[model samples]
Target chain A: MKIVIVEYGMGNIRSIVSTLQYLGVQDVVLSSDFEILNSADKIILPGVGSFGKAITQIRHRNIDNYLNEIVLENKKPILGICLGMQLLGNSSTEDGNNKGLGYINGYVVKFDNSLVKVPHVGFNQVKVNNKLKLYNGFNDIPTDFYFTHSFRMKSDVEINQCYCNYQEDFVASFERDNIAGVQFHPELSQTNGLKLLKNFIDKF
Target chain B: MLRKRIIFSLIYSDGYFMQSRNFRLQKVGNLNWLEKNYRFQSIAFALDELIVLNASKTEKNITEFAKTVSDLVNDVFIPIAAGGGIRTLEDAELLFNSGADKIVLNSLLFQDPNMVMKIIENYGSQSVVASVDCKLNLGSYEIFINNGTKKLDYDIQKYLIYLEELGVGEIYLNSIDRDGTGFGYDFDLIKIVEDITKLPLIIAGGAGNENHLAKGLQINKVSAVATANLFNFIGNSIPNARDYLLDNGLNLSNRVFDTLDLI
Candidate 1:
C-alpha cells in the first residue's frame, strides 16, 4: 500500500522513511502538502518532539480540521507514533496549553513522578489488547520496546488498545477502526518493531 | 512476567576494540551489530558528557549531534539515556526535542545550580538526570567531569546533597577508575550515593557479567545497572539480564512480546 508520512519539521523523518523501506514498503512519501497527505492510501504521522511543538506545527499548517475529517469520516488507516500519537489527542500540557488533532477524546499530560521516572527512558514492556489486527505475528506477550517521552495520552476515548505503566497506567497503543496510533516508535523497536510495521503493511 | 530494565553506554570518542593492554581507535562493527545481537531485556545507556572539557569546541555541534543520535536510536527499541555537554535549558530542550527521553547533566549542575531549576521549571524534575562520575582521591571521593579527564575538589556526598536540594529526578553514579575494567562495580561508592539520596539511582561502570548485575541490583539503593563493555564484549544481552533478575525474584514489569501478532 502507498504510505504517506507527515513531515512537519519537528524530529526524525529519515529514520521513519528508512524503517518503511526496510519493511519492503516501496511506495512511501514524506510530504507536508495537504493534497498529498489527504490523498494517500495509508497515512503514517511519526514524531519525536514535544506535544506542544507538534500541535503548533499542525495548527499553523491549518491541517488540524482536515486531519480530523479525513480520519474520523473517511476511515483511512493512519498510524501516529510518539509525539504523533500524542497529537491525536484533544490537548496537551507540555510547554503550555496546546490543542491536538482531537481525533481521540483525551488530553496529554506530563508523567506523574510518583510511580516511575519521567521520560520513562529506555526499554519497557507492553501488553497488547489482543483484539487489534496490528499485532499479528508476535508471541512474547509483554515484550520490551524502546520509549522516550514525558507527556502521554490520558484519554477517555473509544480506541484504547494497549496500556503501559511508567508512573501509572497510560495509553501505549490505541485503535478506532482504521485509525490506529502507538505511543511507542514501531520503527525504532528492532525486530519486534519491524514486525509491527510488517503487520501494518500486510493487514492494512 | 517480570519487566526488565536495560542499560546502554554511548561511546562518544572515536575508538576501536582493544586486545590485551593496547587500546587504539579502529573501525569496528557496524551499528547493525548493536541492533541485531546485543539483546537485553531492559537496558540503560549513556550519552557523551563533554561539556566541561572545552565547551567552545563541542557546544554548538553537540546539539546537532544529539539530533543525529536520536534518529540513530529510533531504529532500536531499547531505552537510551543521553548525556554529554548538557548545560542550559536550551540544551535540554534541544535534546528532548531531538528525541531524548532523559537528559544527564554533570558539569551544568556543578557550574550553575540554577540550571537544574530552569530544567525543572520547563520539563519538570523527573526529566532531569544528574550524572556523577566519581573517583577516590586520597581518603575521600571527588566528583569528576569532562569525560573523567578532570577532577573536581568538591566532595561527592556534598554534591549529592546539593543535587537532592536541586530536585533532580534521578542520579547516575559512574566509577571512573573502574569504568571499562570489567572487574565489577564499586558497590561502596554506590552505597554512599544511595545513602544520601532517595531518588532512583542508576549505577554505571565496571559491569563484567550477570553476577555483577545481580550484585549491583542487590544493593537495594540502586535502581538499575548500566554497562558498556559487558554487553559489548561479555556477550550478555538485556534478555539475559532480565531472566537472571526474574529468576532471582525481583518484581519487574510484565513484557508482552506477542503483541506483534495483532498486526
Candidate 2:
C-alpha cells in the first residue's frame, strides 16, 4: 500500500517518511501533487509549528482544497499528527485566531501558563478509547507517547477520543471514522508509535 | 501520568562524535565507529530522546551537521533534537527538514533575540529549545554561550525567566562544571533555576550512573535528565540504566510495544 505524507513545507516530513519506511511501508511519497495525494491508499498530515503559519503554507499550495476533495469527499483515511491534528480542527488561538480545515469538530487553545508548562514536552500517558483502528492490537489503557505542543484541543462532541492529562485533561487522539487525529508525535513515541502507524495502515 | 525521560546527548565536532569533559572536546569516533561501538539504532529504543549537537569550534557548517543529523536519525525511532550554532531561520529549517523533531539553540538566545523571535513566529515556540550552558563562579551561577567560550553577565535563574517569556518550549540546562566529571548534577543550581521557569526543564551534564539519574528525577521540578559522557553510557549501558530505573519504580515508559516486540 502507498502512503503519501502531505508535505506543504512543514516540519518533520523527512522523519515521518523515514519512520513509515522503517515500518516496511516503502512506497511512501511526500508531495502536494493532487494526483499523487488522491491516488494513495492512505495519507498522513504531519506537522510541527505555528497553526496560523501552517494554514498559510497549506493554503498557498491549495492543499486545503485538495484535502477537502480527497479526504473529505473521497473518504480516504488520513492521520494528522501534532500541529497537523490541530489544523484538522475548526480553528486555533495560536499566533492569533486562525481558522483550520474544519474536518474535525474542535478548536485549539494555548495551555494555561498559570497552571502547567506551556509546551508540554516529553512522554505523557494516553488513555485509549475503545480500541480504535489507530490503537488496535493494544490492550493497555494508558500508554506513553511523546507530546510537544503549547496549544491544545477540547471538545464536548462524542467521538473515539483518547484523553491525557497535563495540568488538566485534553484530547490525545480523536477518530472520526476514516479521519483521525493525534496531538502527540507517534513517530517519536518509539514502539508505541510504530504500532500505532501499523494499525493505521493495516486496520484503518 | 507523564513519564520522566532519560536522554542521551552525543557531542559532535567536525564529522566526529566527541567525548566532552568540562567543555573540553575529544574526538571519540566518526559515524561508523559510533554505529559499530554503540549500535545506536538498537540503543535508541532504550531512551526517550536523542540529542545531537554540532559543537564544531572551527568554521561551523550547519549543512554538514544537518546531514549527519539525518544520517543518525534515519531509522532511529525517537525524538531527536539537533543544534549547536543555529543563527538563522534557514539554519533552523534545514535541521528540521533533516529529521530533527526539535531545534536546540544556545548562543542564539543571547546573541540575536530578534532571530529567535522570528523562528518562534514561524515554527512555534515549541519547536525551539533554549540550551543554556551554565557554570558556578565565586558562589554565583552564570550562564555561558558560544559553546561555553563566552559567559553572559546574567544570573542563571533570571536567564531562564527571560527564556520563558521568549516562549521556548523547553530548557536544556547543562552544567559546565559537572559535565563528564562522573561526579553528579549541580542540584543547587537546578533548584534556583527550576523555580523561575514554567517550561519543561531538561537537566544535563554530570550523571555517572543510574543512581545519579534517579536522584535527578527524584526531584519534583526536573522533567528529564541527560548524560553526554560516552564512556559511561554506550552500548547496553543505556538499556540497563533504563531497566534499572523501571525496576526501581521510577516513572519511565515500558517498552512492551517496542519495535523489537514486532520482531
Best by TM-score: 2
Kindly report the interface RMSD of candidate 1, rounded to 1 decimal. 6.1
How well does each candidate superpose onto the true structure, as a TM-score? 0.76, 0.97
Write down the worst ten-residue block by lDDT for model 1 chain A: A115-124
lDDT (tens digit, per residue) of candidate 1 on B1-263: 21334465545432221111111122333334444544322232211111111122233466555655565554443334465677777777777666565577877887888877877666556567788888877867878777566777778777888888897877888887777777889888987888887776888778777788778877766767776663344344555666777678764433444433322
Per-residue lDDT tens digits for candidate 2, residues A112-145, read 9888777788889898754688888887678889
Q: Candidates' lDDT values, in order? A: 0.65, 0.88
What DockQ number belongs to candidate 1?
A: 0.18
CAPRI-wise, candidate 2 is medium
- Superposed by TM-score, candidate 2 places the C-alpha of residue B137 at a distance from the truth, in angstroms, of 1.8
At residue B185, give the lDDT of candidate 1: 91
Tens digits of per-residue lDDT for model 2, B1-263: 78899999999999999999999999899999999998888888898998999999998999999999999788587889999989899999899888888889999998898999898887887788899998899998888998898989887767888888787888899999999998999998889878887778899989999899999999887989999989988779889999999999998877657565653
The chain A TM-scores for the candidates, taken one by one, are 0.92, 0.97
Q: How close to the true structure is residue B146 of candidate 1, measured as C-alpha lDDT?
A: 70
